[model samples]
Target: MERVGLYPGTFDPVTMGHLDIIGRGMKLVDRLIIGVAVSEAKRPLFLLEERIEMMKEECGKLEGPGRAKVEVLPFDTLLMHFAESVGANVIVRGLRAVSDFEYEFQMTAMNEALNREIETVFLMADVRHQAVASRLVKEIARFGGDITSFVTPTVKERLLEKYRK
Candidate 1:
């Protein structure tokens, strides 16, 4: 059976760190569905379509026509429901800090309870992205800080445009 995984994130503005995780997760699963979740409580910097578009634009750069499979999707309801919709049994997440581990652990436990068949896998961020996060990037950018080195060139460009507007 082919393995399929769901990678869920607010994405706010999908970062290079996200791409790194997606790149690594692709190797572990036959296909990866990257879901840009819309949260009511957390108003994202970028809308769902914007987030998805940025992710697609960056992911399109990965080489080897078929080295890995990817899809940019969206979910406003439960993540497990979305994962089930696509027949995904695994959830891919990236962990950068200890706080992240705690939150992801709780989320994993909840997801497992919600769907016994689904498993959430946590992958550590690449060394370069270990410190890059959407919140941090936005924080820096909001204050007129340079974030060009934090995210992909495309992300940097989009962020600048967002702030410029």
Candidate 2:
């Protein structure tokens, strides 16, 4: 049977950090599905379609061990439900700090309750991206700060575009 993994995130804009986790996770799992959660709680820098396009453009395509495949999806309902629909048994998450860990822990527990067959796996963010976050990145760019080093060129351009608008 094929092993499918889900990487769910609020990737308002695709960041190098997010890519880092996806790249690394691709190696470990047979397939990775990058799921962008449509959230209404926090203001986003980009829409789901834009974020998916940017991620696809940046990643170029997904290759995995054996016959693994990578795909991008926009999810609006319970993530566990999405995981089930994708036939994924594991969920990959990128943890940058204790705060992230706490939040992920709760999510994992909740997901576990929701789906017994699915398991949540956490991957620590690369040190370079450990300090970069959507909130801070948005704040910096809102004031005209450079974020090219933090996110992908597409993301930087999109941020600037939003700033201008």
- Candidates in order, TM-scores: namely 0.94, 0.92
Q: Write the per-residue lDDT of candidate 1 for residues 1-165, one digit (tens) a residue.
A: 889988898987888788889888888888889888887588888887888898888777763445468888888988889999999989999999898998888988898889999888889998888999899999898889998777887888888888889
Structure candidate 2, residue pairs in collision: none
Query: Looking at model 2, which ten-residue stretch has the lowest summed lDDT?
Result: 59-68
- Please report the candidate that would top TM-score against the real structure: 1
RMSD of each: 1.3, 1.7
Lowest lDDT sum, 10 consecutive residues, model 1, at: 59-68
Q: Tell me the spans in candidate 1 whose CA falls farther than 4 Å from its real position.
A: 63-66
- Once superposed on the true structure, which residue ranges of model 2 sit more than 4 Å away at CA? 61-68
Q: Model 2, range 1-165, lDDT digits (tens) per residue?
A: 778999988887777888888888888778889898888676677877888888777666546345347888888889999999989999999999998888888888899999889888888999999988888888889999889888877679888998899
Score candidate 2 by lDDT: 0.84
Error of 1 at 54 (Å): 0.5
